[model samples]
Target: MSHVGVTLGVMAAIPALVEPTMLRWARQTQGYSVLAAARKIGIDEDKLAACEAGYERLTIEQLRKAAKAYRRSLAVFFLDTPPEGIDTLRDFRRVAGSESGEWSPELHTEFRRAQQQRDWLIDLLESEDTPVPTAWSLPSSEVARLSDAQLASRIRSHLEGLAGSSGPTTSDRYAHSSFWVSTLEDSGVLVLHTSGGGVATQEMRAMSLYFDRVPVIVLNGSDAVRARTFSLVHEYVHLLLHADGLCDMVTTTRATNPNTALEARCNAVAAEVLMPAAAVRAATESLRGRPVDEWTYERIASAAVRFGTSAEALLLRLVNLGLASRSLYEQRREDFQRAYVEQERSAATGGDFYRTKARDIGKGYVRRVAGAHRRKVIDSFTAATYLDVKVGQITRLAEAAGFASASGR
Candidate 1:
C-alpha cells in the first residue's frame, strides 16, 4: 500500500475515550501517584499525566494496561463519572492516638475484596438453596446497658455453646487462635485473614463488616497468633454490637471517654472473655499481696501464656481490676509495644504455600467449597474459583483444610 493509505489506516485505530476524572480517581484511590501508575502500566509518565489532564487519550491496549495496573475493571472507565465508592465503613483508627492516620491502598483493596467475598459466599449458598446463617446481635442500647463483665460472660457462654464438644473449657488447645476462628465460623461469622501486604498490624489489627447475616471479620495474618486471638474477640464484639469498621485495636482510652468508648468496650469484652475475672484472680493469687512494682515480669508472662494473651494485655487488665498499678503498666507499655512492632514487621515471610493460602481462605470456607465439589454440586473450575486457587490445587487445599481429598489422596 501507498504511504498515504498506510497512514490513513493507522489514524483509524480506536482510542479508549475514558473520562479524565475517572482515570485520576482510580489512580489516586489505589494510592498510586501518576509516575508510579505510569511505570506499572508501562507507559510514559508524561503521557499518563496528559491523559489524566484530558489532553490525551489512551489507545484501547493502553487503557487495558491501565485497568490491570489500577486493579479496576475496564468497564469502570466508560462511566460518565467515577461511581460512588466503598467509603461507608467508619474510620475508628483516629481515636487510636498517634497511630491514627490514613490507611494504605492495600488496606482499601483488601476491604473491597472482603466485601466481594461476602457477596460471593451469599450467592454461592443461595444457588444451592442453602440459607445463609444470620449472626446473632445485641441491640446497641442493650449492649450499652450491660457491664463489661456481664457482657463478656454472656458472649463467652454463647461461644461455648456454639463450640459444643470442642469448647475452650474442655480442650487444652482452645488457647489457639484457630480455635477462636473456628468457633466464630460455627456461629455463622465469616472470618478471614489478610495476606499482610499493606495492612500493617499497627495500622489495623482487624476489621469487621457487620451484615445482619454472615458478618465478616478480617484479621491481620501477620500478627502473632495470640495477638490475633485478642483481635478476633475484639472484632467479634464489634460485630455483636453491629458496629463495623477498621480497627487498630488500640483501646488506650477508658470506656468513659466518649470518643473511643466503643473501642474500649470491645477491648474490655475481649480481655474478660479470654482472661475471666475469676480465672485471672485465681491465677495471680500468690502475687496478690505484692506491690504492683514488685510483680515480676516472669509472673505476668506466665499468667498471660495460660490465657493465650500478651503480657501487656494481662498487665493492663490487672490495672483495671486493681491487681496491678497503672503507673507500673504505663512504665512497661512502650517496651511491649516496641517488641510487638518488631514481631509484626518480621511476620508471614516464608511458609508452605498451600497452608498459607488455606489460612487466608478460612478453613470453614475451604471445607464448604470442598464439600460442594465432593458432592458434584460444583465442578473443578467452580471449586477453584470459590477457593481462590487453581483447579489442580483444590485437593491440596482440602488437605490443608484438614481432610483427605474426595479421591482419598
Candidate 2:
C-alpha cells in the first residue's frame, strides 16, 4: 500500500483521540508495569508504550481493551487526572502463620468492596428516621491501663447494649458472632466478612479502616467460626483505638504484638473482650478436676464452648496464664488450626452462594440494604451495585432477608 493509503487506514482506526496521560496514570496506580499492562490488554509492549507516550494513537477498541484490563470504566480514561483511590492507611496486622506477602490485589479489591458497603449504608441511614448512632470512644490512657477483666467488662457492656442481647450466655456460636456484627452496625461501625478468595493471602485474617466516625472491619470468613469471633473482637479493639490496618491473629499474646505497648494493648484488649481471662480461669478451674498434665483438648474444648470461644484462642490464653504449658498449647493449637482449616475448606466446596454472600456482606448490612431496596429508599440497580450482585439477584437476596416487597422479590 502507498504511504497515504497506510496513513488513511491508521487514521480511520484511531479516531485521532489520545488519552496518553490518563492511560499512564491508570496503569501506574494499578501497580502494572508497561509489559504487564500490555499483556493484560493483549497488546505488544512497544505498541502500548508508544500509545501512552503519545507517539501513536490507540484505536477505540484498544482503549476499551485497556480500560477493561486496568479494571476502570471507559469514562475513567477520559478523566483529566486519576481519581484519588481508597486504601487502608496503616498495617496493624501481626502475621505469624500466613505465607502470603505484603498486600495483594485480591485484598485491595475487597477493601474497595467494603468501602462501597459503607457508602451505601450511609445512604440508607440518611433515608431512615433512626436515632443519632453512638460511636464508642476509647478509654483514656489511665483507663486503657485497666486490667483485662475490667476492660473486658467495659467492652462487653458496650457491645451487648449495642447488640441488645441479654448477656454472655451463649447457645450458638454463629448466633453469638452474628450479634457482634449487628452490634457493630448499631454503633456506627461497618463490619464486612470476606470469605474464600477474601484476602490476597490467607495470612491476612482480618483488616480494619478507621475513617473518622465510619470505622470498617473486614474479616476473613474462611477462618473458623470461632476464629471469626476473635477476629471481630480484635478489629473492634482496633476501631476503639482508631488504629486501622490488616491483621493476622497468628498469636494473641504480647509476643505477637510487635511493640510492647500499643499493639500489645490492642491484642490484650481484644482477647479480654472475646474471652475474658477471668471467664477462662473459672472454666479451667471448674474442669473435672484434672492436673495440669491431665488437661486435654477434650476438656479445653468443653471450656471453649462454655466461653463462646475457639479451643485454639482459649487454649492460647491458658498458655499465657501459665495454666497450660506452652508445649501443650502449641500441640493443641496445631490440632485445632488444622481441623478448623479442613472444615472451612470442606464448606467452601459447593456452599450456598447467596447465604455465603450474605455472610460476606454481613447479615445486618445485607438486611438493611435489602430493606432499603424494599422501601424504595434505593432502586434495585443501586442495591445490586452496592451488594456486588447482578441486578436480578438483588430480588432473591431481598426475599432471603425477608424484605419481600422489593421489586427484586
Per-residue alpha-carbon lDDT of candidate 1 for residues 236-270, written as tens digits (9 for 90 to 100): 99888888888887755555445378888889899
| Candidate 2 whole-model C-alpha lDDT, 0 to 1 | 0.70
Which pairs of residues have clashing backbones in candidate 2? Answer: 93-247, 395-408
TM-score per candidate, chains pooled: 0.87, 0.81
Best-matching candidate per lDDT: 1
- Residues 132-246 of candidate 2 have per-residue lDDT tens digits of 3555555568355777667767888877766667445474667767667767876777778876654543557788887665678888876667777778887777776667777
Off by over 4 Å in 1: 1-13, 85-87, 95-100, 139-141, 165-175, 196-198, 254-259, 291-294, 337-350, 403-409
Task: Please give the TM-score that candidate 2 achieves against the real structure.
Answer: 0.81
